[model samples]
Every structure is written in C-alpha cells, then in structure tokens.
Target: MTVTNTGATPARIRLAYTLPAGLSDAGTGGCAPAGGGEHRCGEWASAPGARFSTLLRVRVDGDAWKRMPLSGSVRVTATAPGAPGVVSDDEGFAVLFPPGPPVPGIRLAADAVSFDISGGSSGLEVRLGNTGRVDAEGRVEVALPAGVTVPTPPSGCTTVSPARTRCALGTLAAGRTARLRLPVTATPEAQRQAPLAGAVLGQLDPRSGPTRQVQMSFRITSAAALATPVASPPAPTGSQGVLAAEAPAVSDGGGGGSVRRTAILLIVISTLLVVFALALATTSLRRRMTAPVAGPSAAPTE
Candidate 1:
C-alpha cells in the first residue's frame, strides 16, 4: 500500500488496516505495532508531494479455503495530524488456492482368465498399475466364485472369508505396478463362467471414498479340450502269437462238447445192461416150467 502527500506542507499520517478472517500476515515486511489483530503504522512525517509504499503479505488457512468464499476486504484508516481522520473505502481482494496434486489411477492388465479342470493347480497373475502423479496406499480385495479356492494367495494377502482374499498394498509410487499371483484349484462344479471381482480401496485419497473395481471372469474346461488325444498301440501281427491268443478260447469250446458226449454214452450203456439181465431171467423161467413134473416123480421113487 502506498500513501502519498499531495499537500503543500509536510503532514503527519497514520494508516491502520485489518485483514479478513482466516488470513494473516505472512512476513514482517512493513512496520506495524504488535498485540493487535489489525496492523497499525504509527504517525510518520511525509515530505510534501512524496509517495510511500509498504508490502502487506498474507496467508490463507488451508481448511478454510476449501469451505468458504475466497473474497475478503481490507479496511484502511488514514489521517493527517491536526485534521479529521479520513476513512478510505474498503479495498476488496480475491484469493486463489493453488491446484492440488493429481490423484492415483488404477488399471488392470488382463480382464479375464480360463483354467482347465484337469490342469491341477492353476494360477492367474493380475497386474495392478497406478497412472497418476501421487503415491497410492490401500487394501486390494478379491472375491472368487464358488468351487474355486485360493491355494496360494499373493504376498501380503490374507483370507478374509470363504473365497475372499484381501491384500495390503503399502505404497505404490507413480507409474508403478504390482503383480499379484493367485493360485486357484478348480472343481467339477466350476464348469461355467464365474465372476472374479477385485478393487483397490484407498488409491487416490487417504480417506475412505469410492474405489475403482476391476471385473473379470473365469471358466473351467476338460483337459482334452486343451490338449491333443493320444493314439492307441497297434495289435500284434505274427501268426504264432495270434494262435496263442485264440488257443484258450478254442479249448474252452472243445472241452464243453466232449463232456456232453461222454454223458450221453454212459446213459446208453446202462440201459443195455438192464435189458440183457431181464432176457436171461425170462429164459430160465420158461425151462423150469417145462421139466418140473418129471423131476418130482423121480425124487419120490428114490
């Protein structure tokens, strides 16, 4: 502020000014009295037609700048000794806050993964990167679908619940990336496509706020679908080996036919023996009947 005396005679003058609330003098560039909220310059003798100026440095409160208007007034009182004090009109000024640093940006390198059911223990590497100018500190959380389990979690990660894992990322500098390896085991129930959702909690700001979600999907398939089929071995070609292979089957058929023939022959022989015995008995009976009367008369004469 500059004070000029345009009168013909030298004069004594004082200037008093008050800054707005939430603003204060930054440095002692100008002479002012102490203990008062307002800055006061004591009476000074100014040469006729001479000008005087002093710097008024000020600083704004950080919290107040964000919530309140940036405009304020500075009241100044000027006077010449022995004359009525003159109150100048209020001087208005505008405050401009400096721009804040850029926020952190999140990106996922891949958006989907597929695993074979017979692949045993499979893994997916998720790349998390920051694209802004500030460091990011937050917790990364992942939610896996049913029938899939985290066999080996990434570093600094812990199992929060069934199929849910949380990893603490301490600080990621600008343009840096962190690779998280999530080893998973798939079951038959994990056939169809399943959702795999992940998020970084406190990326841009330290306080809790909205987060960016990285959504992905996964599916399980048969190992045959992923690999080529193996061919069967060719059969043996030599006649000797072929006959040896058929020998047991041929023997089984022949043995069963031989047993059937033996049973039939034995039944025929037993029927013939009974018929021959009956014929011999019939002949002896007939001869005994014819000679029975003569034998009895001879026995009586003796």
Candidate 2:
C-alpha cells in the first residue's frame, strides 16, 4: 500500500485495511487494529510531493480458499496542513485465488521399444520423471501386451498378474527421476505393433484429493528389426582344390571290378602262350639235328 502527499505542505496520513475471513495479517509492517475492528498503520508524516509505502503480508487458509471466494476493501485518511481533511472513498478489491500448482506430471523417456522375440530375455528401462512443481507419491502401473512375459518384476514392483506389473515409486521429488528395469521375455508368439501402456496414479503431498492419473504409451517393435546384421566370413584361399584333393575316389559298381580282373587274366594268358611257342621250337630243332647228317649225304649222291 502507498500514500502520496501532493500538496505544498507535509501531511499526516492514516491507512487502514481489512482482510476477509480465511486470511490473517502476520502483524508486520506496523499494522495494528484500530477501534471498530479495522486494521491500521498509525499516523505517519509524508513530505510534500513525497510517498509512504508499507508491505503487509497475509496468511491464507488452504481449506477456506478452496471452499469459498475471497474479497475485501481498504480506506485511507490524510490531513494536510491548512487543508480540509482528505478522505478517500472505500476502495474495493477482489482476491482471486489463482489455480494451485498442478499434481505431478509423469513423463517417460521413450514411448516405444523393440525386443527380439527370438533373442533370450530382454529388458527395458522405464525412466519416469516428475514434471510438476510438487513431490509425488504413487505407484507406476505397467501393462504389457499379450505374449510378452515379465521374467522378474523390477525392484519395488509387484506382479499384479501375467500382463500387469505395478511398482511403488515411493516419493518422487519435483524435477527428479526414477527408473524401473522391466525384465521381460518375448515369446515367439509375441507380435509386432503391440501396445504397452503405463500410468502413474498418486497424489500431491499436503492435499487430499482424487488420485491423479498420468498415462503414457509405447509401441512394440520386433527385436529382429533392431538387431545388427552380421557379415559373412571370407572364404579360405585355394578351398576348391583342397576339397577336390581330399575327396575319396569313387568307382562304378561291380562293372569296374570285373573290367580290372579281365585285364589281369588276359595278360597272364599271353605270357604262357609265348613260353610254350619257344619250348616247341627248341624241341623241333633238336630232332632236326639228330637226322640232318644222313639226309645231306643222300642228296649229294643223287
């Protein structure tokens, strides 16, 4: 509140104010109750063209503010030297309680995730942050899609059922973050394009009200899509020749064996015929030798 003396002389001023119910003065700023239940600041002198100001702090009742409207009025009286006592009309004002700080806002870092169904157990870290100005206490409710299994619930979380997991978030301070490691196994039947939903249901401290619900959702992507592609290894040098050399020799069925046996038998028979021919020639020669002398003499006499 301010009081100004615009006259040519110094002035004595008296200021008074009234607070509506559900509000109380902290009794500072030299304010006291005058007669007739009006709070006042005693007479103070203000020089010509000078202003006097004071601050008044008030305490508000939360319950009352929540229940009803608030309004009040103020009056000022000033007496200048050699001037008619100046009186100001009752100035009325309305106190509007601006909306209170909202309940804590729950935020998820990522709204979607991909898990490899064929890959063994996989996990997702659900990071939750409080975006509101107040500390929050609540449970984080997580619902997994069908065919998605939670092998182990995160610490401080309970398995409500096969598809639902709930974890106690205790008290989350404003601007702080918490993490829930949701270990889950994706069955082969787990399908792509599934939905994962999560909610933080709780209350803001120092206020009794309905549980606030902050919901977030995630899209499920196939883990195979997120997998890294493995490159094929290079082939060894000279592999074709090495493979051929190491291969076992194959022969046609019984025909190959018969052909080989026939070749050996023909070779043995040719060798025996040569030996018999040589022996017969030798024997004939010996017989000729024994009869040759008598034959030669008879031919000469003729």
lDDT of 1 by residue, 1-302 (tens): 56655444355655666554577778755446344447666666766566877777777776543322233333333344444434232233444332222233665542334555455644655566766566666455555545556776777989887667777767777788877667767554342222222222223332244454433323223342224321111221211111001112245456678788889999999999999999999999998988747454444563
Candidate 2 lDDT by residue in tens digits, 1-302: 55555444565767778776677777757788664436877788777567767677777776544432344456666555544435332333344433233434555543344555465534656666766667777566666656666778867888888877788878878787777667767654343212222222223231343455544434455644223221111211111011001112355676488788889999999999999999999999989989746454454563
What stretches of model 1 exceed 4 Å from their correct place?
A: 1-104, 192-302
Query: What is candidate 2's local distance difference test score?
Result: 0.55
Question: Cα RMSD (Å) per model?
Answer: 46.0, 40.8
Per-model TM-score on C-alpha atoms: 0.34, 0.35
Specify the highest-TM-score model's number.
Answer: 2
- Measured with C-alpha atoms, the lDDT of residue 53 in candidate 2 is 71
Model 1, position 243: C-alpha lDDT score: 8
Error of 2 at 166 (Å): 0.3
